[model samples]
Target: MSATATDTKTLLGIALASGGYACFALQDALVKWLVETYEVPQILFMRSLVIVLITGTLAAHFRHPSILTSKYRGTLVLRAALMLFAWLLFYNSAKVMGLAELTTLYFSAPIMVVFLSILFLKEKVGAGRWLACFGGFAGMVIAANPTHSPNLIPALMCIIAGFFWACSTILIRLVSKTETTLTQMWATSLLFGIACAVTFPWIWKTPDLMGWALMIGLGLIATIGQYLLYEGFRHAPASALAPVEYTGLVWAFIYGYLIWADIPASNVFVGAFIIVASSLVLVAWERRSIRLAEKAAPI
Candidate 1:
């Protein structure tokens, strides 16, 4: 393939990945609002239900093959399990944590992705990418000031959720090699819906019209976000796209301030500046590496 084509794909990946995170930020904001009035399982069940219904209906229109016949069924199941586990821990933790702090902790998943890609995908990560990931993490910490967390256990849960999420992300990249986006979406959402359904009845509360609307909206956002993210992995290496996850932190802060009226300290601005700078540096580094590789290739 031509270098121009390769660059275009990478750029598309970055754009999709960044948009996925933005959708997630919106989801987190919505979940934070809903969790105050509803149980986690109930909320997740509703969200998953909507995703499954949408994906299932679209399957025929999109000509998606049977999930049962997928060669990577095992990996898809594992990824769904990991994702369900992560969401449970994360939303439970959301009860006590601020959106800024919650997303800041979860951003650890991207850093984990950079290393996991090396180990699992056998992708060679450059030192510059490593430094940028860490640097972004540090900036997020500075911005979030999680020292103010009202409860330590919930904070820890958020971090653990990040680990599970990181594993799920790697599996997404792995399965993307063979799976259609709709297939993965249907499989994961079906499994997720079933798991949440098992516990949903115990905590079921009939939502008000508003509650129903919000949860449905959450599911719609999640569908778009998941589709974009899966498409992104299809086009770009996980390690190269990992640092772009930091951009979510910026969106989290924006949403936190807008909806919750959580004000940022001066440190927030400083940290955000660092985060942006580091992400830009990583983009530049990736382009340079791609160019050098193209030059070294024989005609």
Candidate 2:
């Protein structure tokens, strides 16, 4: 590639990652708001339908349906089912716990992922990472004190959602070598949408005009956000952009404060700091280990 083209790609990559953050932040905020005024089932179904439509249209226009390869069919299917359940947990948590609490609790998933990796993947984790995992649990305790509060249930739901998040991540990583990202995205979302559809009869509730708007807005923003995430990976390495995911916590805090009149406890803030710090440490360590391995490799 030409120097100018290379520079353009770099810029696009930065913008894509940043844009992904903005769009997802907005999507989460909107969902939090809409859940209060409408049924979770209605909102989720609409969001799923609209997101699938937008994604499907984009996939078609790109003329790269092959990107959705048929490999990893089983893993992709399982991941999709897990994701649908995760979203349901997410919506319930958002509705009850609002944003700040939910955000802090949900991020504790990384700690779980670390332990699960030890069990399932048999990955080598040093003492430092183990300490960091403990620190994350301490943070969670701070974020979710055992008070007879309405949000306690939601906080626990977020914790459960985190496990599913870890599972989905593991599935994706395990299958990534066998399938293309595009194929995975389409297949996962298709299955997820279908799963969401299966719940329609039980939880369906009539929605208002605002609910409709929020649903479409969520679908569009989330689709755009996910697309930007993919574009970022295309332009730059994952290591450079992975840290940016933490920014969602900031957005969650802001949304909670501005939109929902929800203020986090002192413990929540402190715990969130610990949780995010541990995650960054883990990611940085993993990257260093990878580079060291590459350097030690034979030509």
Candidate 3:
């Protein structure tokens, strides 16, 4: 493909990624509201059920029903399991932490992804990327203000959730090489639904009309978010889009203020600025490296 086509595809990926993160922020706000009245498993069971139904329908329409028997099933299951663990940790923490704090802590995932790539994918890490990682963690520490945080355990859980999320993201990039988006969505949703079902009966609460609507809404938002993010990865390298992930923080702060009347502390702003700067530095460094390599290639 020509340079123009590649640039267009990358632009589309960034757009999709931004939209996906916005949907996720909305989903998180919805989850925060619902969790006040329902158990995490109950909420996730419904959310996963909707995703399964939607993805299942798409799979049928597309006539691509071979996901379960795919050669990459093991990796897919592992990805699903990591996401399940991540969500459980995230939503549980959400019940205690404000959205701004919750999101800032979880925004550590992109930084973690860079390091995970080095470890699992055997990707080379430059000095610049190393410095970016250091800067990102410093920002996390600054934003967290662990000494001052009242909900220390929940804050830690949110950070751990970010780590698990990063693992699943790496898996998604790996399997995207061979799997259709529908195939990935179907497999992940099926396994996620089954796992949520295991403890769902014990924690189940019959939903009122609003409760049902919100839970289903959560599912719909999640489906759109998942589809958008998956497609984004298809078009752009993860490095190209890492900075786009920060857009969720903007949405998180907006929703938090609008829905809950929550305002962030000064430290949160400082920390967020640092984190976003670090990620941007990493992206810029990656682009410079790519350009230099292209220039040096033999004719």
Task: Count the clashes in each prediction.
Answer: 0, 1, 0
* Top TM-score hit: 1
Q: In model 3, where do residues sit more than 4 Å from their true spots?
A: 1-12, 96-105, 124-156, 270-299
For all predicted structures, in order, the TM-scores are 0.93, 0.70, 0.82
Candidate 2 lDDT over residue span 1-299, tens digit each: 54345435544554576678767778878876787777666776777677677666766777644544555676777878777778889887775674446665776765666666667656566765666566656656666564544466777788888889777755655665455455566666677667667777887777778767778888878777866765665664333333445545556666778877878888768866875675566446545555665566566
Which run of 10 residues does model 1 get worst, by summed lDDT? Answer: 2-11
Q: Could you give candidate 1's per-residue lDDT for residues 87-167 as a string of tens digits?
A: 999999877787568868888888999889999999888887887888888888888776664578988999989999899
Q: What alpha-carbon RMSD in Å does predicted model 1 have with respect to the real structure?
A: 2.0
Best by lDDT: 1
TM-score order of candidates, top first = 1, 3, 2
**RMSD after CA superposition, every candidate:** 2.0, 5.9, 3.5
Q: How many pairs of residues in model 2 come into backbone collision?
A: 1
**For candidate 2, what is the lDDT?**
0.65
lDDT of prediction 1: 0.86
